[model samples]
Target: MLITIENRNYGSFKYKNSTAYVHYRNSVVAEVPIEGELVPARGKINMTTSVDLKAETMISNPNFMADVTSGSLNMTSTASLHGKVSLLKIFKFPATAFSMCNISFFILTKSIDSKCTSKIKL
Candidate 1:
């Protein structure tokens, strides 16, 4: 299921990008793209965010579906954050992002693979 562990701004920060992926039995079942572009926030910055990733659409994997239906499925959701939130601008300190989670694609940076094994519209 799609779970948002963190929603409150905690204060404004920025990421090059982020995405969500559904995996079953070590296979990538689908991708949920997080939309945004790089924008410099003003002296003081804030961002409102929510993922469009849907839990209902996570039925593309038959085995997963069967397990889930049978109440024998073992599933977990994880999140990784890699940005500074010490200040509203978050960029006050000089640092580089070392990691993030569920980023399945990218358009600007060549750092991520811009393709997914499969996709289902949500």
Candidate 2:
């Protein structure tokens, strides 16, 4: 599965050196680092990356597993993210966000159908 994490800095403090992890079924499907990067206040960290997730890990049926890439898998899954938010590049705090995306993968379309709405805990 290809996972992309976009973190938004809503507060006035700058966020830096954060890492994003995509969790599905209590397993980490994707991990991306926000190293040496900065998200200005009221700005956002945009990252595009891909991770290889085996079909067997997600699907138990052997007959349908082989056709995942052939546009046979049309489904939606909920994913959560965990990362660090650094203040002024000094103090770091843990941040958690939940993104709800409607996974609609087709044979001819490439579109990101996820939207994240989060409340960072201090």
lDDT of 1 at 51: 43
The alpha-carbon lDDT assigned to residue 39 of candidate 2 equals 48
Candidate 1 accuracy as lDDT:
0.38
Any runs in candidate 2 off by more than 4 Å, and if so which? 1-36, 62-95, 98-100, 108-112
What C-alpha lDDT does candidate 2 achieve relative to the native structure?
Answer: 0.50
Please, what are the lDDT tens digits per residue for candidate 1 over residues 1-122? 33223323333334444555445445544454543333233333334455443444445555755665554433322323334333554334422222224433222343433221221111
**Model 2 worst lDDT run, 10 consecutive residues:** 10-19
Each candidate's lDDT (Cα)? 0.38, 0.50
Question: What residue pairs clash in candidate 1, if any at all?
Answer: none
**Total clashing pairs in model 2:** 0
Each prediction's TM-score against the native?
0.37, 0.46
